[model samples]
Target chain A: MSSQSVVFKPEISKPLLQEVMDRSGQNVLACYQCRRCAAGCPVGDETGVTPDRLIRMILLGEKNEAFNNLLVWKCVACYTCGTRCPNNIQTARINEILKQMSKEAHIEPLNPKVAAFHNAFLTSASHFGRVNELEFMSLYEIQNTRSELKRGGGWRAIVDKIKDRAKLGISMMKKKRLHFKLDKIKGLSEIKRLYAKAREKSVDR
Target chain B: MEIAYYPGCSLHASSELYDIQSRMVFRRMGVELKEIEDWNCCGATSAGKTDDFLAIALPARNLGIADASGLAEIVIPCSSCYSRMIVSQKKLADDPGLKNTINAELIKKAEGKIKISSILEVLVSKANSGEIAEKSIKNLEGIKPACYYGCLLTRFPCDVEIPDSVENPQGMEIVCKIIGAQPIDWSYKTDCCGASAVINDTDTSLLLMSRILHDAVARGANCFVTTCPMCQLNMDAYQEQVGEKYGIQKRLPVYFITELLGIAMGFSPNEMQLDRHFIDPFGLLTELKLI
Candidate 1:
């Protein structure tokens, strides 16, 4: 997932902080490390740090820590913490922000599998404009397996993946029932233009 | 209007209960759905991950058939399918070159025409609150349900924000309240359950689901409701797995919003496909005196 490295040294400006707070709410600055956001976050226990802590780190301009921490990667983007934050913080959105920052900074991915999946997700959207889960999962597994092999332990797992291919194929084949024609949508051209614009923006950023 | 319905792969397999309950719920709600004569796959997450053209083509092919068969909209019960179809539809509607490529592929697969829509949007629009109000047999009281949107339902339509608040939506809550249930304030309404990955990746799914269950229990919620079959399957079937792994034994029955509505309307467990659920929704109904 890392095409480049992003280095941050807590040089956050006031306007950026205000913009996040405005989109989310002003109470985000009121978080006092109570960890309520983490306590209630659905993915918090699975993550290294709580959602509240992640947000605090960001608010305090701990840009490097916020972007590089594994906590930022573990978020499922479920929006649980965002809905429950007493500080009215959009923890999920903040997580999205961190993810984007990580992408920009090219931080080492905590879970290369997820990063592969994320890349696959974007690539699929950019190309076809919709995700085909079966293809996506297969590609995700392949990419993840390749990443694992690069780290020197994925070869054994490859056999298991191959052994399970039949079952996987069965599951993948199940996707055939809900197909639809794409030519009839009233807004096809605009959507493609927007997608191209987005891809360019992300690449530029 | 009779429209072709694609229940997706999951509805026929992993979470057939959603398919069953949705059929019953839709029937009661007075909406007619006819299955497509010969439908193909939508090429779900895997397709989307690997090949963009395949992903769009998968869902697009299905819509083409529905359209050719003379149905403007194909109502889908599975959240993944709904999201895929909507995203694909929007993409096709927005991109001419992609639409041409997708349409050409679809014509070879099917001889029909169709549009795509999620059951959630169908409930909100096609079979509206007016119809629901007219056919009301029971109203939920003292049962504060938190309408869980999961992720697929609201992520698209990036403009106009069709459902409710992007973060915490109340559309399902409003639907429940309209049918007479008091929607509660819960923290994990939009949280993911580590869904389809739970099969391949256990630890993460367990950890995530445990946190969600813990949050709901802490909020004093008696039950959980959702639109996605994967979310329902993971949340319900994996509850045991999660508890076993974490040593935290907490069980909150998860129901398809349709099943809850079925019961509220005095429908039996059989009618709502309660017997098919990993957790017996009937047990919760009995506890709530809803059955």
Candidate 2:
């Protein structure tokens, strides 16, 4: 915590705040720095970024600082914070919008695996019109392995990961939760078009 | 009562027991579930992070299909799916421009605005009206269950409108009482079980799950009754993992709320697929003489 007396700048760009409010339908300005959001957050203790702090950063126009924080990715999207907010700020929704903005700005998340999992999930859904759990896990593992190797962890890290998943994977397979074949929902073309249109619109934004 | 059923991806695959027990319980209650044709994934927590439009569009597509089915209401078994569907409906209702764009993009019209409901909501209403109590054949007086709501079921007060108090929900408790089981009060009832984090960040996810389990155990809960499949999977399948990590020997079995309801309704263990859980619940059922 900074002990220095805080100075408020008179002329601050509020584009990020405006965009967040506009996109999330949350009243970013209504937040009064009440720590109720942080108090109710389930993962608040695990991360350095609290819901109040994130809202404060946004209010202070620290868009880059707030967007770069790993807390954005760490949020479980549980909405505990939102439900507890006195002003109904919807802090979880703000975090989500920030996450999307971070991706749009091509900012690599501090937690790569979370982003990787999201990418793998969307990829699977877009292709099959539904999630194929087996395929999704495989793609996520492949991405993780590639990134690990690039970071110079080599085959040891890959082997370790496989070993970690081996027991659970076998159990899931035995229970018939995991499958060998890909399951595709009908009307793949419609889903493909939706994905294409979303991509096009996101790019336009 | 007849309603459109949206099982989502998890129900069709990983969480098939939830689907089975849900159908069985509802069937016994004379509620007919018409499965939504060509329903896709709700995108869970992934789509919103990857793409905003797809997040809303995926669930909206299902809502459109459900509306077209002539059903005025849709019953969603998974809390996550319920949240996504409700949120999507609210988003479309709030933003006509976005809804228009999505409709144009998908080339399908969303008509008649179908209502989305969670399985808990449906069951609790029946229990409140004495419908469940009338149907329940087996008494579960010996079972002490900690009803777990997780996050999605009662969060976002403005959007996901659960009938019970969001902070201290009683939907599951109502059903528990109707079936003659004791519902214990415990903290972390609405806490996140770290959902997908169970796959990506095992250590943190285990820690969250362990805390919830420890709390329920401290409150003298014999087992967990949950509405969400993700919560069941994390708490039930990972019970052994958490026990090993925390050096605790207590293995509390977790069951879907519908599974327990089925048991009370005189459905056999085989009918509910109770044997398929990672932690075998047979011992617990036997102790209560419910099998």
Give one clash count per candidate, in the order shown. Answer: 55, 0
Which digits, one per residue and each the tens of the lDDT, describe model 1 over residues A1-205? Answer: 6696544444563445664555333355677776766776655655667877776666666656766665666666544565556656657656555555565567766666666776665554434444445555567777877778888886777888666655545533342322233312333353354445435545764
Best by lDDT: 2
Q: Judge candidate 2 at residue B223 and give its lDDT.
A: 91
Candidate 1 lDDT score relative to the true structure = 0.63
Model 2 docking tier (incorrect/acceptable/medium/high)? medium
Tens digit per residue, CA lDDT, model 2, B31-135? 999998888888888876567788888888888888889888899989888888898898888889888877875545665389888998888789888889889
Off by over 4 Å in 2: A1-12, B157-160
Report the number of the highest-TM-score candidate: 2
Compared with the true structure, all predictions reach lDDT values of 0.63, 0.84
Q: List the residue pairs that clash in candidate 2.
A: none
TM-score of chain B taken alone, every candidate: 0.89, 0.97
Tens digits of per-residue lDDT for model 2, A1-205 = 7687645553563787788888888998888888998888777788878999998888778877788775687888888888888788888888888888888888877777888889899888887888888888889999988777776787976798799888888888676666466667786777887888888988998
